[model samples]
Target: MSQLRSMYPPIEPYSAGTLDVGEGYRVYYERVGTPGAKPAVFLHGGPGGGLSPEHRRLFDPNRYDVMLFDQRGCGQSTPYAGLEANTTWHLVSDIERLRALAGVDKWLVFGGSWGSTLALAYAETHPDRVSELVLRGVYTVTKAELQWYYQFGVSEIFPEKWEKFQAPIPLSERGDMIAAYRSRLTGDDRATQLEAAKAWAIWEGETITLLPNPAFSTSFGDDQFALAFARLENHYFVHDCWLEDGQLLRNAHRLRGIPGAIVHGRYDMPCPARYAYALHRAWPDAAFHLVEGAGHAWSEPGILDQLVRATDRFATAP
Candidate 1:
């Protein structure tokens, strides 16, 4: 078998800055690789996970001009962890703003997990502007999807972690996990919020991989990252990402001609394989990959191999 592709070597952003995207928001963006080389954009996951230097290495540094950014309140974006004017549509608009800022008529759109949801939203809204699409972990933001991760499905799989996740809210409030978390995540008690954040964040970290990844799991426990990740994620899920149930799947026709790649792990807990299968059925034009022995993280070997192949394939698309 051929070697599984991995990230290109780490490279710092050649140019980085903050853009005032209105509504008291300054979205942070960075450019890596040749400035104006084959244009592409990277959308980070978590709704608030922000960008990492590793995201820069997803593309071939010598070939693609890539943009990675912190959406709304993420990374270097303003009012750290603030959730005003932040919604699926707000983020879709942010993508358009960034695309305009890139000065390219169209560029490759790559997103994973929550990023996949945003990529679909953006591409459906502005189908004419996307040159190519690459999605990973394929979250559709449906009520069923939300329940799978936060309420019952994953809970059974990780009972101990679920116990920690459940400890934040009392028994009565447990019926609606998203609502329960949303209450404290937005509540004024700093102590309660941070406690809930760490628990909420760690749940995702602990369960996202097929096997244990201590470093990956540990980072989710960071006070700062946890707060934003848990808040943004709970906020988005509670609102169903402001999407009509099954809206993205219903609109997959918009992606039919977009030339895409959908990669989902077979054992992904947060996002089930069925949804990715549904998307594959809807958008038959894009290639579908169901990786064996992997979970949801893009960092997983099989998942990363597929992601790198997708980026490299599109790096020189016409």
Candidate 2:
């Protein structure tokens, strides 16, 4: 097996399942590894995006009971990006519900990028329920972070792509890329939505992975992918991730004593290492692992190895 495969070996075959979390909504989830092992839950990024098979490898199946779930309106959930009870608070409640359904008193939380933001928020609200945290490519959803992602960050690094993303919308609309995309994506004009989605995906792809191009196609040819991408991003941004200003940091007091490890790529463009540094300063007790040459892609061998190791260590600990 390749090193990547070895680090994240497939576990005992498991089946996918869904739960009715009330309000006529169902949350989709999958299980891997043994039932009696230490529980570890994976939160996917994109708010609207659901968990993928690759996410299961972050923990050692022999030692950890791994769970990957798509939040409401995401993945296999009943309504894709359905805004009803889909705020950040609702997500936290869903995690609690999932824990009870999975029959675990506490579980390790593993997340990256936007997932990391959710993990932090959830941990803050339910510190006692979290055994530990394994986070990477930390995203806080701060005003500065959003501004950087939309206006200054990727544009400074990849000006050509930035220009293409900005060209479709007028200067007045530039202040809020999320709003502009929402207008286009929800309009009656299919062509407009396609153009806007392409621009949005292109800008996101350029910064998220190490590759020069996005892993996803820009064409709205895939209805599911395009709809999920557009809807989830808009939901999170419109609500500022359902977080007040500096809420994550403000809530750090709850997580100050938690056992946690943060892994961030030094060169990550999506969520800069500076955010990781700020997190470290707040929770000085947490371990910070800096991946020198990697970007934000968790698929990178170095990041995968580090993540697996962190999970193993946390799972095996007393």
Candidate 3:
């Protein structure tokens, strides 16, 4: 059996700054690893999930110069959690702008979950600019995909967690959980908003892991984190992420010539394994690894092993 790899050692950014991406949005980005090694960009998940120090450890410091950024409203970006001008395409444009700023004609694109969705959009829109693609916990945010997670499928798996997720809204609004949460998440009632936010955020935190992880779960309950996570997630889901149904899968051909890897945990709650399988079928050029005994989080052992291996394999590739 091939040995499973792990994340590279923790490292600090050699260069970091915020970029003015227009509409009053300043995206926070940083570069890590050797100054002019192979270029790669890391896209954090959640649509709302901001960049973290741990994310920088995904690529080897000696082999890659990776760009990690907080998209739009989250993290250090301006107007924290603001929704305007935050769509799938806006993010794609921001990425292109970042590329131009970095002066790299093409770079590797790595993302997980919603980040995977955004990566697909960006790659499809500008195929020539992507030298390679590495995706984990692939989530396209289709209606069926969204419903499987927020509405029905995962609910059946984690009834207890589902109950907690459903607690913020009354039984009457249970039929449309996304909309119900949206009313509160984007509402004027501060207390109720926070209540709904924690519930919404915690539900994802609780269910995403294969086993119980209190510290991981609790991080979702943080006030500011929960507010941005809950609101932005709901906003994107409510709009189906502005994606045509099955768009990412339908557009998979765009990534064919680019070297790629698709890694997914068998038990990933937020993203189903089937979609990753579907993507693999559509983009046969990419290697696919269905990790055993893992969940959606990037920290999952089996999933991380595959991701790290993919980065290492492409460290010197064109």
Candidate RMSDs in Å, in order, are 0.8, 2.6, 0.8
- Candidate 1 per-residue lDDT, tens place, 1-318, comes to 999999999999898898888899999999999987999989999988998889998899999999899998878899789898999899899888998999999989999999999999999999999999999999998889888888889889888889998998999999998899999999999999999999999899988899988997689999999999989988888888999999999998887678999999999999999999999999998899999999999999999999999999988788
List of clashing residue pairs for candidate 1: none
- Residue 234 lDDT in model 3? 91
Backbone clash numbers for all candidates listed = 0, 0, 0
- Note the Cα lDDT for every prediction shown: 0.92, 0.80, 0.91
1-318 in candidate 2: lDDT tens per residue? 445433566554475788988887899888898887898889988766677776787777778787889888867888875766778888889899989988988999998888899999999999989999999889899988888878677679878878988988999998888788778877778788777766676566566666554354433225566566666777688779889978898778889778988988888887888888889889876889888778887877677778877887798875
lDDT of 1 at 265: 97
Model 3 misplaced regions, further than 4 Å: none
Better of 2 and 3 by TM-score: 3
State the local distance difference test value for candidate 3. Answer: 0.91
- What digit string (tens of lDDT, one per residue) describes model 3 on residues 151-241? 8999999999898998888999999999999999999999999999999989988988899999878899999999998888998888989
Ranking by lDDT: 1, 3, 2
